[model samples]
Each structure stands twice: as C-alpha cells, then as structure tokens.
Target: MSTTRSRYTQTRSSTISDDQIADLIYKLQQLIPDDQIHTTTLHHHKALNTKVLEETCNYVRRLQREVEDLSQRLSELLQSMDNNSPEAAIIRTLLMSP
Candidate 1:
C-alpha cells in the first residue's frame, strides 16, 4: 500500500478516548461566559478548517510542479536520444508498427 494510504488508514482507525473527551468538557466548563462558548468554538473550528484547506491546496500545487518537472526531464531525455542509434530506430519502428 502507498505510504499516504497507510498513514490515512492508521489515522482513521484511531479515536479520542472517553477520558480525553471528559477532560475537554471539564476544561470547557471552566471557561467564563458560557453563552460565548459556542461562538468561540465555532470560530476556532472555522480557523482550523481554513488552515487544513490551505495546506491541502499547497500540497496539490507542489505535486503538480513535480509532475511538470518530470515531464520536462523526460522530454529532454527523449530529445537527446540519437535517431540513428539502433535502439532508437527499433523503438521508432515498434511505435510506428502499432
């Protein structure tokens, strides 16, 4: 399996334990102004969501750039191949035959 797939599987299988949840709830309860908790939590979640989206976009762009670089290198290598060389001639013949 791919490294990314394995990591995702591992993360998916993991869950927050009940003790953690309880601790979180206890902490939340300690905060002042209970009426503003909901709004504060929503804002915090929104900020996290935005950060995740930005990171995902950056990763995608990096992958795209890597793919483009690989494509350019492959084109350069192909261009460097001697047309008169037996291997190149054979490859051209095989490609044309198909």
Candidate 2:
C-alpha cells in the first residue's frame, strides 16, 4: 500500500511539473518574434527555445553597441559646447544623476 501511494504521488508531481514547464516554454516562445513551433513535442520546443535565446542575445548585444556609440557622440557634442552655458550645465547635471 505504501509503495502504491508513493508511485501515485510521484506521478502526480511529475505531471504538474511537466505542465508548468510547458507553460513556461509557451511564454518564452511568445516573447520571441518569428518563432513558430509546429510540433507538440519536447524536442521541437527545446530547439526553438535555443534558437530564440541565441537571437535574443545577439539582438541585445547589437542594441548595447548602438547605445554606447550614441552616448559617446552625446558626450563629445556636450564637450564641444561652451562650458559656461546654462544648457550644457543642465545636460551635464542630468547625465550625472542615476
């Protein structure tokens, strides 16, 4: 009787975990654009997840580079302005704040 109860508990727990995993994977898939999951299998979902993650990483890196370039240009432009100007002082103060 104990063995049977243990098996039943384990099976139920596993099923719930599987459901949770599927739900998370579905959410992740929805976040990535152009990700199409055609099959209802774990392998296909895993593959799509990997692809989505790689694409997201690459996109984030590209955006970081763009932000860095823009920040550098802004700093240079600010430096070229007259240091005594009210506008430059305001901008420099804003940039220094968290």
Total backbone clashes of model 1? 0
Best by lDDT: 2
Writing each residue's lDDT as its tens digit, candidate 2 over 1-98 gives: 23333433454454334355456556876675554544556566677677876576566556655655656566666767887898877876766577
List candidate 2 segments past 4 Å from native: 1-40
- What are the RMSDs of all candidates, in order? 14.9, 20.3
Q: What lDDT does the true structure give each of the candidates?
A: 0.53, 0.60
What's the lDDT of the predicted structure labeled candidate 1?
A: 0.53
Each candidate's TM vs. the true structure? 0.46, 0.54
TM-score of 1: 0.46
Residue 22, candidate 1: C-alpha displacement in angstroms? 37
lDDT, candidate 2, equals 0.60
